[model samples]
Target: MLNKFTTKIVSLSTLNNYSFIIPTYQRPYVWGEEQIKKLLDDVLLSFTTNKESIYYISTFLTKEVGDKAELIDGQQRFTTLWLIALVLSEMTSNNSEISTFLKKGDELRLSFEIRDEIKNYLKALLKKESTSKFLNEHFIKKHPYLENIAEALSTIKGYFLQLSEDYNLNEFGNYIYTNVKLVKNTTPTNTDLNKLFTTINSAGIQLEQTDIIKARLLNLIKDEKIKFSRIWESCENMNNYFERNVRQAFPNWKSFNFKKPFDFNDNLFQHNEDVIVTNPKDIFSIDDLLEHDYETVNINTDIKSNQTEEINENEVYCRSIINFSQLLLHTYRIHLFKEGKTDFPEEFHSKNCIAIFNEMIKRNNTEEIKRFFKLLWKVRFVFDIYIIKWVTNIENKTEQLELMNINSNTDGYYSRTKYEPSSNLMLQSMLYFTGDYLRQYWLTPYLNYLLQDFDNVAPTNNSHLEYLEKMDNIISTRGGKSEKELSFEYLKTNEFTQQRLDIEYFNMHLGTGFKHYWFQKLEYILWKNWKDREEKNFKNYRITSRNSVEHIYPQNPENRIQHPEIENKHLHCFGNLVLLSVAQNSEYSNKSVSVKKSMFGEKKHTYDTLKSFYIFQSNQWTPKEIEEHKSEMINLLKMHYEKTFF
Candidate 1:
């Protein structure tokens, strides 16, 4: 009678009406990078390769109550799957249909019975906050178990962050809800579950894998199960902190992928000796975490007033999006001498990167564990400083900000202008080189000397000048050319700029979609060089703009050319693509040259006047003009920057 239980191969959608309660007596959610990656890869592969096929995601043992199920044996798997659903919900939070499916009364309500804090955390997550952000602000500072959950969640979030580039969230969510099945075994309500669950595992003492890990970690940090657990769990989600903070630190970071926890996390704390010192009040204290409730914790404004340093809302939002694996490869190859001190391979591939980190903890060295967090904070600060550039050094890039400042002079007449950038083109150029997704080969080394106060990438002091120099050397080494160098070479060197162009370099990554940022640059460049200059500089023009690239000539033109011999490849060349506002792009979609030009003047503010002016320079568009304009652009841009293509 104790052995008998019901089983069902139900789709996730079927569980919309049923809530899940992970009993606190169960182990903490310990699915690290290995389990997180596998589940994501399997589910994604299933969704894409065979949409209709049912993927059996192992058995989950639970006991159904009135509207909820008490997870008995398969809590980890169920918790992971529930997290996957949360990821989907997060991505599509704006869609009413999906929002209802994810959060309505009929939809699943996952709560932890043991820790109301953890349950409160989940409830906060559904309210559209970054999981890692919530982790750091609340639980990571205090609760050890939640820290583990946070790391696992971060790894999970990081994987999906990568997949989001190639895979459709809507499709993935649909398949996961409607097709993916799991064998759920509900034990009879009368069974002695604690003993049964314990017997099912090898530990035999009712100890879980988490408990075993806890026991092992306990040796390193004696008399502090609570403290060590908090530190250890935070490391697991350490990747999240890296991904989120680094993204805001640099541009094009959102599309970056960190497949493993150690990818960025371990590199952030490669060595323990180099601890960055900061005020104790800067970091949230355990008392601060415990004193706050979910709402209070979620309200970042409440915490900032008590802090020694105040970060603005824009900076706070900027720090929330991050990805940083490519940099890890650099550190992996150079700093670690091609391998971790532990046996885990030195290469920066696969989820097993954490193996070396686990080996660090396995040493039972409390200092080593402590060092990891210290280094992590240092790296976090470094990334945080770079994010400040979004608000700080932006004027250097000639970025047109939205804000307007007004003043009254002697006559009491109002005068107005956007605040100006303090720096020049070099700052913007190198910032984009390191920040851009496709143009990542020219990356700088992580120099400790370049580090100043805080965890910021850019120093707070004069060392930042050296960081800028390093950026130039790195970018130049990896084939990125400055506007000045390229412009001079094109004009004086008589650079065969167009012919030497790598056609594939312009090709967008199918997975990462890295080419779109070029339009922003191009838009800035075109506006800067506009023959029809306004009193205000293009860089300082306060106008709302969309960064989406659209083909000036229709990609698939309705008005067929007399010479249809032109290849489709030439259609996407820099000559043909132009930055357009969303509404403007839709209006000009597949329209003929004559028609686009007629309205181009009307909506000129939404487009690059130079590009539009050049387009209207001809009566009709053909492969000949496309080639001519391509060379013209190459020539004009080179002349503009005094640099040229090889």
Candidate 2:
């Protein structure tokens, strides 16, 4: 019969007989703030309304009552309420009422197998640690277990803290009384509850197929009518079959998925219409699972509504890759247990284990699993390179080499050792590589070596000079240029010097560098001055390389026809020594023209300065005028510099 449950404000003492059931698979006690606030709010509201005969309750349907109440459903909510009660008990002056409540809740004891774990949980609650600490300490303390309680505890604690200021004790208690409701006398079987839990909490880490299989088998074996000893013996008998068929078939299964029992649905795995029905030849045993032909079932559920982002192709691929990688744990576990190797660590052999790790490619069939495989493979190859560089004289290309101070030899063979690496080294290498690629984008093999010592990565005052030395050596070997080399070639090169002088010094100082068309004006000015100087019979007229362009004038601009401006006839026009070096012209900077004429009389060349000056004066001064333009002169300089650089 369906039993209707209602809230009642029965004294805490009365609750002793009515135990709260939290199944083994149910999470440890976790009460975060939000849940605590909700409870407090509800209790406060109830007090304001003067509600006396009400109690917040949850209903559960289960197959058994003695021992631990096999949690069918409502584990998260129930465990959270229990924690709140404990906190309330601590707050109240009287201890008897709260003690009674706890006694009743603790009446359903955990099986002997997990008694230590149960004790640990109770101890954590009694202590004044953070809610997360309490739950994680018990549930997630080690490997292969689920911690539903931790989340619950966190939520409940956070909730209470929020309401502490606004609501008084009475009001808070009442709020909880009204809001936190649990149905009474609800009869849901363990299987039913497990199914519901799986369905509701499918988003995080869904139960694996093998977990469901194990659940069914466990449920069958747990039956009182069935002799458990015989079942165990049968399991032993069918060990080979189970391992060969079930274990081998689901090689990638993880125990985390089997935290709870199975929720069987007939429709999910329906019988086929292959009609030769024979009397059961062999009774189903845990061992004989291989011989049995059970149809597999998987449900296709929609993505949760709470998911904010639509999964992209990359995300899908990544998730798949992670899932496949996780399967190695099962394979390793099987090998360890079968070989009786109790000392073997439960961690997966990702480095050496050869599973179906596929590469993630852009083409068809490229998914997360594939990507994970490729990434792992690439990292492995890089690690191999590091090792090769380390053992051999070759320089390592990876960043790790620099850290290790290993010299780089681009061309070197990777040396092989006859001995296999120790387990610790292997594990360390795996972790280092995994973290490096996944976190840092660098897959340096040197990380494997660096991470060997815990203190190396620690933030302490220990000297890291040895490591730094190794790193420098590695950097050198790897062909990374030193700072000294960079300074010489890139910093102090001649090209840089030229660029600096041209832009910083010459361009800003004189307007001469400004215009490209000013060369003609400059030439005209020089020629006219040259002629005046020649007429005065100046000597020592020699061309200079520094300022050499052309000499067309006498000492005065007006000596020929370019310009008539004159102070002394020796006032050289800007065009006079256009082609002479600055050094050569500066030697006669303020000298008179007669001085140069006497010096030049010794050499009677037809194209001497005086003769050349007349020839320039004979030409139309328009050409000279144009040649004297500053823009043309500047252009000529610009062209020369550009050509030199180019």
How much lDDT does each candidate structure score?
0.47, 0.32
Worst ten in a row by lDDT for model 1? 298-307
lDDT per residue for candidate 2 within 303-327, as digits (tens), equals 1112133222211000111122233
RMSD of each: 16.7, 35.8
In angstroms, how far off is 135's CA in candidate 2?
11
TM-score per prediction, in order, is 0.40, 0.26
Candidate 2 global lDDT: 0.32
Best by lDDT: 1
RMSD of 1: 16.7
Q: Give the best candidate by TM-score.
A: 1
